[model samples]
Target: MRLFLAAIFISLAVGFVNACSPADKAALLAFKAALNEPYLKIFDSWKPSSTKCCSDFYGVSCDPTTGRVADIILRGESEDPIFEKAGRSGYMTGSLSPALCKLDRLSTLIVADWKAISGEIPACIPSSLPKLRILDLAGNQISGKIPADIGSLGRLTVLNLADNRISGCIPASIVNLGSLMHLDLNNNQLTGAIPSDIGKLTMMSRALLSKNQLTGSIPVSFSNIYRLADLDLSMNKLSGLIPGQFGSMRVLSTLNLDSNQFYGNIPSSLLSSSGLNVLNTSRNNLEGELPDVFGPETYFSVLDLSYNKFKGPIPKSLSSVRYIGHLDLSYNHLCGTIPIGEPFEHLGASSFANNDCLCGSPLRTC
Candidate 1:
């Protein structure tokens, strides 16, 4: 009786093993064969003989009912111990395998933190993975233009391809990404003007495109991104006046447009923004008086408006800010008495250096 029951249990186990899709297993094997895994032996268990494709692989998960691949989270570098150990040498090389698109049910595909994954992203990826909600290939060596039809991935909410070798203009088709919220393509070799209709991404909260070769003026349509909270376009070739519509972002907190070629007066709407905390427009061609809109509730902590062409007295309202940790108004045309406040007193003369005419504690008295 004991021997018969053991045999029945073995039979049930074999039935469960057969439930995993053969196509998904074949795709995983193809992907493994494409990678150069000399240092990272994480795919040792991806044996073709093993029937448990989903359960035995290092970064694969499948739905129990359908036995289809649901997530492929093979992160090379991260704070996680397993990923760090696998990518410790930072040498996982090879082109991305097109076989990855065979997993029909895949919703999340994150292969980030591997700086050695070279070559162009498969052009068919956008059409092949319609169910993908989060596609992050950040901090890799992937080169080539962003897929022109990337907007077809309607389900994607977060698209991060930052810190790569991607070049060419951002496709206007990306405006079709209606559900995208976080779009980061910073630190790349991309050129050309920002798409005029980028404001169509209404769900965007953080749009970081700094440290690139992007040129052209701020698009007037940017006023449509009403939910934008953190906008960083620093260290680029972007020129033109800072858009006054940006001040309308009620939730905006961090705005870094430093090291650009933007000219014209600082927008009054931006100066009066109550939600702003970190504002840096240093090294621009702006010319105007500093705004006197600072209030007790104003969350200005880091105000860097240095190397501009402002001309006027330092605003007395600067004393109203309760928490200013970083302030630099040096190298401007301003002529006035420096405000002697808590944070201002702590600042050095360098903060007010190279101005046309300045006086008070940090400098010689007028």
Candidate 2:
């Protein structure tokens, strides 16, 4: 009787495995499709069934009760999806059928540092996958401009579209991403002015819009972003003054405005920006002397004011900047005498190169 009972128990286990519903079968199809996907080669050997646990699938995760594939993590994993056959990495080139939208419990979707995924992002991305918390399409070949209807994803928190060929203006509808904490759109071909209502993204912590063709000055409403920590607007065609409203930001730390066409003086109030530590105004058309408002005690570091039209005597107050390092004032109209200060004393004429009248310690005597 005991031997017969053991045989029956084993048969029931096999039957239970065979009786899994079509949902599990759909998951397996998706999983097999993911295996051949150039973006998922890192999981080539993954066999979730072998281990009888979702954790066995290298980059795939599942919902607790439904046991359906939900989250997909492709970045910072053990192995990069090999592109030896396709000649490019992260090449997830296939139609995103509505089947992908069925992942109702999905949360995060990271595809970083992959380069070959082409074609439009899943059209149903925003409207169907409402539970998505993070959506990173960074470092891919995604070519379409950000979908103007992106606001449909009300639950999205992190949106990264950096390092792509995506063109067109940032859609005004993006302001609808009320839950967003990080939005990176750098290193693309996007043009047009930043939308005026960008301040509506009060939940953002880090906002990157560098290396594009975007024009116009930053909006004043940006000052209201009390949670903002890092703001990068460098290497675009953006012009106009650094708004005084920036100084009002208590949490702002890094502000990069290098390699733009921005003209005029650095706002003295921002020079004394209490929270500011890293400030770059290099390769612009800025004029005027460095401000003393950035007291010696101020925490400005990594200050680069090089390749601008700034003229007049070097401010002695700058010598008090004990924390400053990597100071580059080359190729400016600054003249008169170089300040006699600790680090300034070591800088040579090369550091003040191409200046019309800069003389004394750094350069030759006037």
Candidate 3:
């Protein structure tokens, strides 16, 4: 009787192994077949004999119960020299495989930082992968407009397409990603104004859109993202008043809007905000008196407002920022005695250079 029970248990285990979906097996094979030689080597473990794709397939994970592919990550190891050879670059090469869409259970697809994958992102991905949560194709050579259909991936949380050659206007439909938290499209050729409805991403915490060709005023609606902590929109053609509503971002840590055409006084509310760490608005057309309201509560470490039209005396309150380390007030129209103290005394003449009639310990006597 014991031998009979053992035989039954073995048979059940074999039956479960045989139950692996045939359709998923064919789909993965088709996806691998689409890639070229050196790239195919990355998947040496993917073999015909390995019927259990969940265990044997390279960079592929499967659902334990369903035996369906759930993740596909084919990124190259940058630290490995064998992966960086000239013509034999160890990274996966070729356009994204349409066969990949056949895996109905796929949730995370990240093929990034390889620099070999070219061509557009599969247009059908959004509809094909309804459960996808992370779609990172950054640091590749993929070009062309981001498909508007991508917004259909309502379950998405992290979308990173940075460091690519992608171009064209950012689709307003992207704002539909209600669950998205990190949106990075920096260092691309993206043009046109940022979508007016960007504030719809109320859950987003960090947005990096710098080093693009975007233009027009920053949408006023962006202030709605109260969870935003790091916002970098530098190296674009954005113009208009810096949104005063940003002061409401109680947790904002780094705000960089340098090298744009933004004009108007720096928002006094922003200067008074408590948790700010780095504020760089240099090389713009900003014109106003530097606010003297910063204090011990305001823990700014780097303040760069150089090469602007600011005019006024150096603030005595500047010394009150106990953690101030990097301060640059040069190339502005300011007239007054420089503030002297621990923070101020540590700064050199260059920090206050090119300003109008600035005199004190760092310069001649006032």
Candidate 4:
């Protein structure tokens, strides 16, 4: 009797390891049914006869203990052996099926760069997938508002939806993403004011939202993010004074606020920030004498301040900067001799073109 009982226990353990949850298999099949990827034949291995859906299906992973689907990583632009054999990138046309929410244990879902996946993000995702850590569906044609409850994903760290046609105001609750580190929404059709509490995302390192229709003043609260390194809000309709606190950030290296409706003097602290190296404020209503705040720490790869209402002589402090790779002060109302320095030696006439009464080596001598 003892030997028979031990054999039965061993058999049950073997069965547990071999069996795939029927519900998870069904959910995956429904998800596959909605999309069509003809070239790669990626889903061909998803067969009903296979008992191990976890091991059999392409781009699917399952938790070993519970036999539940855990991840679905399928990138259209990849260096996988399959893409190398096919000699082309992936192209799929279909909506993401809501059945994906049935994978309640899913941790990471990345179906990115397909270029033609058109559909609103499954609204049920936030509430249904509590364990999700990385949700990336960028480089697609997906449209519609970001789910309002997106902040409910408490464990999410990377949220990338860039290069899509997604529209609508960034949800206010987005500031609640306590664990978020990388927030990218570039090249979208989004509009409205950035959340005033965006500074609450202390974990964020890069906040990129360029090429949108955003409007509003730069929030002073943004200075609270000490880890923020790169902040890009260019080509938007944002107006109001440039935040002086931006220069006080701990690790901020790149600042782009060009082509907006901002008006006021360029913040002097910005030109003196030890870490900031890239600055562009061209094509706005900014007016005043350029700030005389350049120092030994001033090192810029690109400093574009053209197409504004700046007047008076170019600041002599600019000549003392450590380096200036590309400088553009054109189309302004400035009148005086351009400063002579190593930083300005390589600049051409176009760098100072169209400025009123500006005369020097690059321009006509005063």
Best by TM-score: 4
lDDT, residue 200, model 2: 92
How does each model score on lDDT? 0.85, 0.75, 0.84, 0.91
How do the residues 1-366 of candidate 1 rate in per-residue lDDT, one tens digit apiece? 999999998877665644468999998889888877666677787898988877888778877667788888877665666656655743567877889888768888888877788888788789998998888888889999999999999998999999989999999889999999999999999899999999999999999999999999888777788888888999999999999988777888999999999999999777777888889999999997877887776667788999999999988987877777888999999997888777787899998999999999889988
Can you tell me which runs of candidate 2 are displaced by over 4 Å?
1-40, 43-53, 76-98, 346-349
lDDT per residue as tens, model 4, 1-366: 999999998887666655569888898899889898899999898887788787778888888788788989999999999999999999998988999999999999999999899999999999999999999999999999999999999999999999999999999989999999999999899999999999999999989999999999888888999999989999999999999999888699888999999998989888888788888989999999988888877889988999999999999998998999999999999999999986889999999999889999888877
lDDT, model 3, position 329: 91
Per-residue accuracy of model 2 over 247-341 as CA lDDT, tens digit each: 77999988898989899987887777768888888999999886766566667666778899887877777777656655678888877777777
Candidate 3: count the clashes.
0
Write one digit per residue (lDDT tens) for candidate 3, span 146-233.
9887788899999999998989999988999999999999999999999988999999999999999899988878889988899999
Superposed on all Cα atoms, the candidates' RMSDs to the truth, in angstroms, are 3.0, 4.8, 3.2, 2.9
- Name the top lDDT candidate: 4
Model with the higher lDDT, candidate 2 or 4: 4
What is the number of backbone collisions in each predicted candidate, taken in the order shown? 0, 0, 0, 0
TM-score of each: 0.91, 0.83, 0.89, 0.93
TM-score of 3: 0.89
Clashing pairs in 3: none
